[model samples]
Target: MTLDWEPAAGRPDLLADPVAEAILKGGLTGGPEGGRKVDVAAIDPTLSDTAAFCERYGVAPEDSANCVIVAAKRGGEVRYAAVMVLAVHRADVNGVIRRHLDARKASFASQAEAVELTGMEYGGITPIGLPADWPVLVDENVTRRPFIVIGSGVRRSKLALSGEALVAVTGGQVLALTV
Candidate 1:
């Protein structure tokens, strides 16, 4: 099924504040018109989760990406990062991700922390507009996809863009982030 895709640059109404700001500011380049080619579509808020969204939208598991927030702690310091993986796979949070963050332990961030820190709803966090200091780790498999669906930083909508575009917009690091 076709989603009502529209240029993300022009659809701030469908985006959360940070998401709209990121796209409007031209992604990471910070140029006058440096936004990546992204599309947005409104969806049922109750079905915003990966499985429900994919099923209701007729999106394949491999064509949908989930962005999870990780809290890595070491030596009394805590850092947060965003991990992007296909819905079909799970992010290696305790293994590869922990090592990558140079932390003694890594796990999913608390919903309150994620929502507060990212200025996004709990179930609607996207890699885009994440804090610059936070690393965005994209699973290699995700980068190979021509297009994928991800959250719009709000439960009411979804974003669609090429995996390459996602990397460019978020300055994502491509790696074997999934197991």
Candidate 2:
């Protein structure tokens, strides 16, 4: 349950990814007790999706956090958020999220929109470097893991850290957000 991350520049796949670079450079805000923050582990850049990543890295699906961008609209205002949930479950986007956002409806953001808005690849958008104004919703289950593996906003690497550090980095609200 410990975080072991190497410098991103030492890995070619991660050297050019901004989000991965941000995590490696200590750009995320907030600190847990003892001043421990966050860290990144550069993996094979070709592991482009969650399933491949976990299996290749000897990580379990339940131990990896998935970041999903969701949106809703009311009165012509679209509210967007990047929600974190473990790979073992799904985000209650149409239920808990619709209620949380106070919108008439909610749905996952399109891949194109998510990539464009987050400035991260479709398979790698993470909560760490999301737009400052976007709220990060973390599933209560996700925060319970001693350590969680997450996307680094690029296909080339992953970020690994404590669950508490995740809450701190995203400034997230822990809730029963999975179905």
Candidate 3:
């Protein structure tokens, strides 16, 4: 059976983004060659808050994985990066991630920087279809859950997938990287 996607309000252009296109075509995990269908849902852009989004969708915040990209500066060089952190455990910005990225200084990417570099809207970035070289760090806690809700490559929508499936697709490293 083919999976269908529901479009969100006021953002029909979202369907054109590479990331969203990837999700609609390949699913949250890209699926196995000819795998079971994965469902995609769109919501009002005003309901973009992580907690609220999950609540409306009947998913617990703890069961949702938030994908955040941080730009770090090391030796005066800036690097773009992404991480999959369980909503329950915030990314260890000052601890594990800072060291993992080998940044002399690390911080969340500014709204403008994130959108400009990733071509993804803020409040809606996922590691699934990111650039090939971008480092994707997955928090240990996220793997413990059966499934997670992540961005659908757009701010107005999100995709759900099995935790194991996510690891398999992204080839992401499960690390003790959360605060």
Clashes of each: 2, 1, 0
lDDT of 2: 0.76
lDDT of 2 by residue, 1-179 (tens): 33357533344355325564555565542223234455456677778588888777788899899999998888989989989999999999999988998989799999999988888888888887777788899999888887778887777767766787789767898888988
lDDT to native, each model: 0.88, 0.76, 0.70
Q: Which stretches of candidate 3 lie over 4 Å from their true place?
A: 1-16, 21-38
Give the CA lDDT, 0 to 100, for residue 153 in model 3.
Answer: 68
Give me the displacement of residue 178 in model 2, in angstroms: 0.8
* lDDT by residue for model 3 (1-179), tens: 11234332223354327575555445443322334323355667777678777676666888778888888898879987888888888898878998988998888888888777777778887776677788888888887876567776676666656676677667788889876
Off by over 4 Å in 2: 1-4, 7-36
- Tens digits of per-residue lDDT, candidate 1, 48-109, equal 99998888989998999999999999999999999999999999999999999999999999
lDDT of 3: 0.70
Task: State which candidate has the highest TM-score.
Answer: 1
For candidate 1, what is the lDDT? 0.88
Candidate 2 matches the true fold with a TM-score of: 0.84
For candidate 3, the TM-score is: 0.82
